[model samples]
Target chain A: MTTPVLEARQLIKRFGGLVATDNLSMTVNPGELHAVIGPNGAGKTTLIGQLTGAIRPDGGDIFLHGRRITHMPTFRRSRLGLARSFQITSVFSEMTVLENVALAVQAHSGHSFRFWKPALRDPALREAAEQALDFIGLAPRRDEQVGNLSHGEQRQLEMAMALATKPRILLLDEPMAGMSQEETARMVAILGPLKKSVPILLIEHDMDAVFALADRISVLVYGRIIASGSPDAIRINPEVKAAYLGDDDA
Target chain B: MSMNRATAANMVLIALLLALPPLAGLMDGEFYIILVSRALILAIAAVSLNFILGFGGMVSFGQAAFIGIGAYVVGAGTMHAFEDGIEWLGNGYTQLALTVLFSAVAATVIGAISLRTKGVYFIMITLAFGQMLYFVAVGLEIYGGDDGLSLYQRSEMPGLPDLSDDRVLYYFSLGVLLLFLYLSHRVLHSRFGKVLTGCRLNEQRMAALGFPTYRYRLVAFVIAGVMTGIAGFLLANQTDFISPAMMHWTRSGDLIIMIVLGGIGTVFGPVYGALAFLLLEEFLSGIPVTIAGYRIGEYWQLIFGPVLILIILYARGGIYGFLQPRSNGK
Candidate 1:
């Protein structure tokens, strides 16, 4: 009944002569977990980049809550409650865990030019960081440097950082990437509760997590959305089976 | 990681540095306060380079330009102020500080423009700008052309103990170095510094999380320039001379070598590096024996390079890397 939280209509991206993204379109409603599955080099990462304002689409518009945000910079998009976890585990390796989340909190709060008073003493920032860390069960290791975190814990820290931005639409590019089976299960559990609160656009290769977590599924092959429906209907779509989802459908 | 511990650490460090010079005198006269002053001043300059190379991960080869700019500004300003041997700036030190400020401003403007490019491009562009400035100094017919401008007197610190005495100047330089170190440490510890570190570590991640990483990097570049500019100020006063020689690319290389030689990421490491570098320079020149009887004086840095390579190859993180044993790929 309400406008989708995010909408991309006829998005087209071309690099040199190669159309990395071709007429791709999707919409995520309020508090919906929409999973986008595609083969490697199918322009999935490129689509995410365009959505988060890293790359510009040659054509089409991206709308956030019915307002066009086609040409906004990445920081502005983030300020507007759009957050994305990088596919690669990118973090301030030299900084402590608290400092990492504290930065995200600082970003969401206001300008950080407050240089005289010590920032580490700001209880508000610390509390906000702790809340995010608590949500991801990373509160125990808050004092440790991020460089010392385990692969799974680092991924959790990434999600915690994104959550600290207080985003409305969370763009997750392969959250389970490089995770062992145990870590993957933990991520699924973590995303389960978050799925109820935020509209998540997930690009995942893990079929089990997608089937368990995604409210709706979109099959992208060769940069085109070939099928979109409930989990069962998407499973039976012949073209989706041929292009993708076939191997994972056990 | 509690705020209390961080504050305590800073307090202790500041206390230790402030008390160090007087204690050095207690040891013996060999700690010539003038040499201490020179060391402290160079450390301040090296700290500025540390901000760019260590924290921001930007390897700038133009810091010497900032140093030269600061030096020449003071030298030229003093000369112009004393036209036909007249009293210029009334008091020389105030004039020198203003010159340093001007150099800081120049560095900021230059850094803001050059930071737009990344990686090797950034290095080359900064080097290009430094070369241009170097040539500008070389081309200046007035103010001693190739020969450096000399001040009749080192800038005097007004309202303080007469800094003309060697020990007094050493103490003053000590105070300045400690102040710069504390300020630098504070800046790096602040939220501003944390975000800058974030930008350096993972710029894409910082951007995606709503930071204009480019703006942050530019701000960092400017801050480093300004800091280096101040060091340049002290240097001119210390040497009582200014020349195009200070701005050479090889000088920039020396600064890089200092930071890398000591350790890149460690805050205190560059200070140690500067001490080691200068001491090595003085010591090697003073060495009684030379292999094949060739002077190893200017070529000391050649030895320093191989030593740095050994450190880099053996200890990836430099001395701190050896001490801390950071868990990479964890």
Candidate 2:
């Protein structure tokens, strides 16, 4: 078995008395799409926060490629091939779509201390940004301002930016959260091939999308995982049905 | 289309500034040259402030402290030359070097502390630092304390044109202003500038993308301080005096106002703002009207305050936006 590309070992995070993440452990192996599903207020957001270095875990550790990164800064984590898209569609609104993706590309190319040549005009940055946008199917709107893009398109731009970082593992926080059915289908298409290139630890509430795309699904309930297994196995898990999935779905 | 309009206005403004000395001479308005030069020097300060405030989203209220630092560098050097018989301190090279060094040091220290806070706390802490400098200047009795220091001689530029002539000084100020404006243009388009701007738009997002935004903002703050310090160097030479009032908190407020009035983030906005502010001050204060048997000029702020309100209210992006409304969704 290959070493897991990303791992969370007994992670613990507390907000006052509420345990946001409680001894939660998980792993994503090479080229696997691992989806995490849970009901609202089940600590999914908190879990992603810890993975992305936005929240400090109260105890335990996280490792990227078997290297401990629990205490690293968010940017350092990103530099180490971890990229995340916000659940609420965060993009640079004032900048053009291409420029937005180019910034992510710039982050990976080298240090951005080069203070003379325009980043937009740089061939390497532009080509990589364009390729990411093309892959996310936003190539036609690359010149438009991100603020002017439709809600679904902005989410796609977010994906393009995350992809431009060329991450070893991607942490997507509800990339489909406010997207339409057609938009969701479009995103699934993008993610279908994306998982083949980089492993994904997806936190999403869309049940159908989860079952269709997840190689393995982890059911989180009140900060603890009740079960983690193959999508079909998770579907049959009685505890998951009791804690999260309702009787109709079961 | 709006970009072109802004570019045209910038070109016209620069042309007018370039032609001012000769034009003033023809009109026998020699005093106008000095007044415009003072505006140019202050414009440099405004541009520096805009770098952090408008672009980097770091509203530093202590900018006047850097200007004060630069001015005092010259003032102290000249004082030593006349009283202590230390001529080396009076050289332009030494004064310029000291201004850059001291301003960089002061900005680094202040920014390192101030950048730790955000929003109102940042503003207050910067204001506090400015007042700290102001008080320090007030306490120095040997350098005139509250009265201010008078420069017996301007710093001697060994290889450059003499600044003793008022016309030469005015042109010098114009040249420096042009240089800084160009430098700002270059920086705002650079790769580093893209990161700085991204931090301004959404810092958390920038960090998620792997840019250390705090370090970027700190560097921008220091750059602004060093530039404003150079303006302060020119300012002391322009006025032939330096005092605690140079770094007064109100002076910082005035710099922010200038940025807002001209157009906050636009490249030429500060120059437009500085010139407009000084022109307004001169025009409003000299209004020879006696309305209701009361001299209107003495209480010009009554009228001045409303004019600014109107500009801010109607001009969406300040005066530059007024000149060319930003084409939406570019």
Candidate 3:
């Protein structure tokens, strides 16, 4: 079997008395969108944090393309094509949308130690940023200051920034958190074509979007994966239905 | 359009600064030339602080210590020249080179430790480092300890214009200031500046996007330190003396004030800020007014405090903000 693009092996993270991420393992393939859905405090964000190198696991390891990277710094992990969006929209607000994405492109283009040449004039970085923005449908608003963008647009800008890094896999944390119905639909459309090139690990509460996009689904409860299978299989699985869908139905 | 206003204002400022020495000669006297030169030197220091403080969001409160280090290098180097016949130490060119080298080295050592912390802890740690240097300066007995040391002769470069002439010194300092200002402007717009500003705005995001912000911030801190060190070198030349008092924590606080007053983040804000601050200090100190039957000449600080408070309260964008068009003022 081909190696999974990302794999977590027995990850454990404890927060004093409560284990935030219990002994858990998961894998994302190169061309699959794996969705992880759970109720609040289910440790989905913690898992994402661990995957992105923001949070270190107390035990076990994470591998990217079959290489162990459990102890790499966040920036190094990013350079290795592991990119994640913040749960909250986090773009350089004082900068223009193009500038924000350009900075992301600049990160992977080369070392940022070049101090004399103006970055806005860099054709390669600008082209890459523009492509990302165009892909995310934010090309029209490219010149606007990110601070002036709407919340949903800001989230799109965040995706543009992540994409500009040329990630091998995208870890999206609540991309539709504050998005309106139309915005969510737009985001779904924007993300539809991306999975063919770069796999995504989506942690979302919007089950409809998750169900529509995910090739496979994992149900996490109290920091542990209770079930992992095709969305249809998990939808009908007794354990998942009883533990999670039962609550959603009511 | 607003950018044009800012550019035009900057040009006018540069023009005024260029015209100052002759204007001083025509108006006030040699003292005015010295005072304006002092302002230019302090402006250089303030501009350096703005790089980290405004752009990088690193509230370093120890910048004066680097300046102090530069001044002391000159002081100690001069003393060593006279005592041990260290020929290179007496040369102005060599002294400047030594000051830049030593200051960069000091910044590297100091920044490596201080950049480890963030926010208030970062501010406090930098302050602590500044105070540490202050004490070290005070303890140097050979450099006159508390009494400070005076330079009998300013360092001189052969075949170049003498630095001893007040006009020559003023123009030389102005030239250095412009060069640094240009260099800083380039840096602020470069890829390095974007990353630094990105780190300032969202460090976590910058890291997530593959920027090693700590190293960028450390380099920026050192750059600011070296630039301020240049200011310190000029200060030693301007004053012809060196003392531990130059590195006092309050002096660092004053540098912060200059940055804030001018407009913390803007490129030339510190220049405007330094000019306003020094001019106000001169103007206030010269006036003797009776308020409630008490002389307020030496008590100018009492009035200055309230004015600063008023500016902070109403004009959040600062004096430079007030000058720019409202849309892009910030």
Recovered native contacts in candidate 3, as a fraction?
0.92
- TM for candidate 3 is 0.97
- Candidates' lDDT values, in order? 0.80, 0.91, 0.90
Off by over 4 Å in 2: A248-250, B1-3, B328-330
TM-score of each: 0.91, 0.97, 0.97
Give the per-residue Cα lDDT of candidate 2 at A97.
96
Report the candidate with higher DockQ, 1 versus 3.
3
Q: Every model's DockQ, to 2 decimals?
A: 0.52, 0.75, 0.85
Model 1, stretches more than 4 Å misplaced? A180-182, A247-250, B1-32, B84-93, B290-293, B296-299, B319-330
Q: Per-residue lDDT of B175-235 in model 1, one digit per residue for the tens?
A: 7667766776777777777776677787778888888777777777877887787777767
In model 2, residue pairs whose N, Cα or C atoms come closer than 3 Å (at least 3 residues apart or on different chains), thus clashing, are none
- Give the best candidate by lDDT: 2
Candidate 1 chain A: worst-modelled 10 consecutive residues by lDDT? A111-120
- Stretches > 4 Å off in candidate 3: A247-250, B1-3, B291-294, B326-330
Chain B TM for prediction 3? 0.96
Instruction: Kindly list the interface RMSD, in angstroms, of each predicted candidate in the order they appear.
Output: 2.5, 1.3, 1.1
Error of 1 at A187 (Å): 3.0
Across A87-186, the per-residue lDDT of candidate 1 in tens digits comes to 8887778778888898888888877655455676889899999999998889999999887789988998999999999999899999898889998998
Docking band of candidate 2: medium
Compose the digit string of candidate 2's lDDT tens values, residues B273-319: 99999999888898999989988888888988898899999896888
List model 3 lDDT by residue over A53-119, tens digit each.
9999999999999999999999999999999999988888788999999999999998999999999
